[model samples]
Target: MSLTPLNNIGEFALLERLAKLINIYNKDKVIKGIGDDAAVIKPDIDLVQVVTTDMLVENIHFDLSWMPLKHLGYKSIVVNVSDVVAMNAIPAHVTVTLAISNRFTLEAIDELYEGIRLACENYKIDIIGGDMVSSNQGLIISITAMGYINKENLVYRNGAKPNDLICVTGDLGTAYAGLLILQREKKTFMANPYYQPDLQNYEYVIEKQIKPEPRIDIINKLRELNILPTAMIDISDGLSSELHHICRQSNTGCRIYEDHIPIDMMVSNIADEFYISPITMALHGGEDYELLFTIPLNQYDLIKNIDDISVIGHITDANEGMYLINNIGEAIELKAQGWDSFKKEE
Candidate 1:
């Protein structure tokens, strides 16, 4: 085992050393590798290309304390894949760019890439090419994903119309509740050195926070049924935020039923322990990484039979605007007051 003088060697030197470690998935598609301003890849076939990127920063997006390097790498890919899934496309390739400070070592880098490489295998995506730079700040990982879709099958955020049904994939807010548990556990550890945090419980909630998968299967099923979302966006923001985006983009209004929002049983129990309503967690709590979109009213029965797809609401006339129809029938405005790490005061 050996330690790298990663700091003293400087950023460019580290990049030079790391150059040996990476290669394009297809040697032929790589017009240029690590040295240039960017790496270019030839488009596959006459297929339409979709591109998306995600950035993860230390402490803000991840904590090294409990997060395994493998899960972190897997998460980076999932976030990018979610963007492709939002577009109703199957993600086919990804390029990972990493920035490191003096804190990490060669062994640590291997663990991180080990996770990244495993995600490539699971998602059936190719690792094209990427840049490794040394930074003065803590670790940062930025991933760019590429996906392919038929021109006719493409889904975007700007297609909703009146009477379209609002649909979402899987459960929501489990990830958000899971995050609360993780942060609380992390705090407990920092407060008492002798106290071992009791994490005997909350495994399911924790798993959602740590390793989320993009809903590509649902996208495929929808396509198989000859259905296309009137409008679509991944649920990275809270449900309230996403619905608002669909409404604004498509020049439509929406109404969601409070009871229809999907929430997992484990998340519900944990939320009760924390004195939080699972519904509130799903509504305003972000990071579910699910898909939220609208479909035509006639397509409702076609989509409902599919497992995990929930018809939470529907698009309405422009005058109605976007709001949630509570169980008691009271209407409330939808607002997106989600996590804003960039705005936090140091």
Candidate 2:
């Protein structure tokens, strides 16, 4: 017998290996199983069901010193809800499970639930049920969100066609900027216990990191405008990485412009302060939780007036190749240089 490190093979590879071991019994009921953002189930003829789960662990996914328990609770739910929204589905219910150590108090657990309650209220979802268990390690939270969409309205990552307009909701890279600031502050505080972190200036980015809202509003707006996305995925990873998912799934290529990638001024300033490239951050920063979707070229005029959505690029023929045209007019092949949790850093 031999032992191998999971990090050496990486997350996607690990997933692929694990997926090969499973047997899908009910093929008709399981519309989608292991690949997409969520698992699609055909519970009925007219309606399609979506189930998505996200798990957050202490230190690996978050730091308790910087990440408040309340925010963690809220974020766990939001991230799962974002997956449902990525499928163009409305989240109706969620089940949350928590693993806590002796260090976590009853009051602390209540605080976490309060945040979950607030998110449920804001998102108009019900907390159906979940589990609570003891953990020898640190805090861990997992949320599974279930939602439904009409069979006709359901969108997947593989639906984009040539010439479809690529769109994204809100801005990108703010969460990574916030994480940098928090880590910097944490290091400072570790060196000096009396020092108080001046986080007022980095409020927006910090909030973006700690408390992210799912793109339910964008889903609602798209529905109201009668614009169904041809292909879509939530930017849980990075813009470039998610774009790769869409392009690979749809069997199409994309041409996004550097100038058109939307970024907030606050994020830009913070990146500048950190001596990092804003565009690079936008492309490779993870945990943005924004929706990346494509629409038919003709439908562009309808969504152009929508303030938050940005038309950054358009889908192209697979033979044309995926690219990012720089400001100086150079076509650079896009790469998925985003965060990989399982990767072992060289």
Candidate 3:
């Protein structure tokens, strides 16, 4: 068979070419998929629908050298699902679109989807529909996640009030620490081809980077405790960035205690090796995928003893401004320096 460029075949033909291989099914919920103007789905009547989309691009979002394709596939789905969960919703379906260069083979695509399929099974979600197209450069994956929540259980970023306790699920900075370690290893490997990557010592931080779990458990635990967050956002863009988002949306300020922020011992040890503060990583690092939320002061007693959660701060009047109080009682203005996609690297 002659090797044909994707441009020679055109969009419709390419779609037709890939359509035969797609086995996306959603039982009775997906009434329409491909060959239609839009996907049609039947949502549960008692649940309020929530939607979120995320994109990952090669080099920018991930490096193929360090990121396994299967893990990349799983991470993509998890990130979108994390957004849905952040809104206090349960993910039910996903639409996956891919843009790939000719460098990708059918086997490669299958490998990627294998991870997606695994995630779907794990999360109890369905792959309703999506699109596939050719790319000019490297690979790109975009996913749109749909979820549902009862109206009374819905959460938002603008519902925080003064005196609400600011809390975060799981430890922070582990992912960023993992990335730093990977980058350093990659550089060393590039310089010395015979050098073996020593990742076993950094297993926890490394796993935190490549296989970070979304805080679905936090949402479940909150429900089990009969508590609902007044305002909530996922820690995709670091704790400080998420805190700023909640404060800006809720029209409130916050004061977080540096000592109160949760950090894994492994992450702190790793940060020491990197010559950076673990607190700095927690404040500005991104992609931890934990849940950061605020609850009423009255609800504090309900969550005081929850494992893997920390009450790091409290909401204050907007005029008070966002500040971080160090252990010695020094207050520093909080800054949001999370990942900026558009900003050119210096």
Candidate 4:
């Protein structure tokens, strides 16, 4: 029997295959292509359009071994919304396409949509359209989100300026730690079938990993505060990686304070148990779904007084380079070591 193609290929390659299969909708109006977090479309109106797509493959982005289908569905939309938020745009709609193998039952699909429904309700977006296809492989979900913003309001990675204040919304590293807890529990269960997996104490972190809320409210809140980010990127990737994108594209440097990086108490306690630095995990660990941004110095007072947002550091001239300042007052060069989905080890 001839083997199936998607069975052997990985998630990214499969995404590449799918990307090639689709025809461009507005080839001429497309200001940006499909590579970044969202596609930039210059609609006839003054407002620019932003589009983003995400694909989740079993055993790659997620593991059916432990992840619930419902959480998976909810997470699918949130991830897409996070991308739109990164562009400083509001997520207005999403088209979810699901590919399911024979292994999943109709009831399971309903459970999955339950999460999808919940996300739509929370994000206040409509499920405009999508498709359902059969797969010989495991569960696969792809989400495409559409966002809108005024042309002048659109923010990309290439706008940070020297002396700009670096700020982030919500905390970091909790989702990454949540991933660790889930994987660790899976291992514990695999090692001994009787092991129930000690995850009760790690509830908060694990919940963060399973179902994350996109910072749509924060985006609106920033507008209410009359703050415009000089540059903005979501924390789907590590903080260091997103910061590097900001610094490199903006031709600026950032000095992130070690003590300023936010960490939930549960995340810190778990990091201590694992013999890891909470700050390190928050910086290098990926998928917090928070916003990393730089605002002009005049806006410093606006963010500094905000309880939910923190002014972690300041941007500098590109010649200075990106560095992290420890509590001891030493500056260390920051590295953007993002999680590699393809070369991931079990």
TM-score of each: 0.90, 0.86, 0.91, 0.86
**What TM-score does prediction 1 earn?**
0.90
Model 3, span 1-346: residue lDDT tens? 4454555555576555444444544555667655676778887678789999999989988888888888888899999999999999988888889998977765566568777877877887777667888898899999999988899999999999999999998899989999999999999999999999999899988888998888888899999999999999999878998999999999999999999999999899988998999899999888899999999999989999999889999999999999999989999999888765654132
Best by TM-score: 3
lDDT: which candidate is best? 3
Counted clashes in each candidate structure: 0, 0, 0, 0
What is the lDDT for 154 in model 1?
A: 92
Please, what is the whole-model Cα lDDT of each candidate in the order they appear? 0.82, 0.84, 0.86, 0.81
lDDT of 4: 0.81
* Tens digit of per-residue lDDT, candidate 4, span 1-346: 3334333444454334434323344444456544455655555576777989999888889887778988988999999999999998977767677787866655566568778877877777666556667788788899999888887888899999999999998888898899888888888899999988888788888888888888888888889998889899999878998898899899898899999888888888878978999988888777789898889999777767777798899999999989999999999999888665554444
Between candidates 2 and 4, name the one with more favorable TM-score: 2
Q: lDDT tens digits, residues 58-153, model 1?
A: 878888888888899888999999999899988877878898876787667767877787777777777666777877878899999988788888
Clashing pairs in 1: none
What does each candidate score in C-alpha RMSD? Answer: 2.7, 10.2, 3.1, 7.5
Give the per-residue lDDT digits (tens) of candidate 2, residues 12-42.
Answer: 5534443443344444455666566555655
In model 2, the runs with Cα more than 4 Å from the true position are: 1-45, 343-346
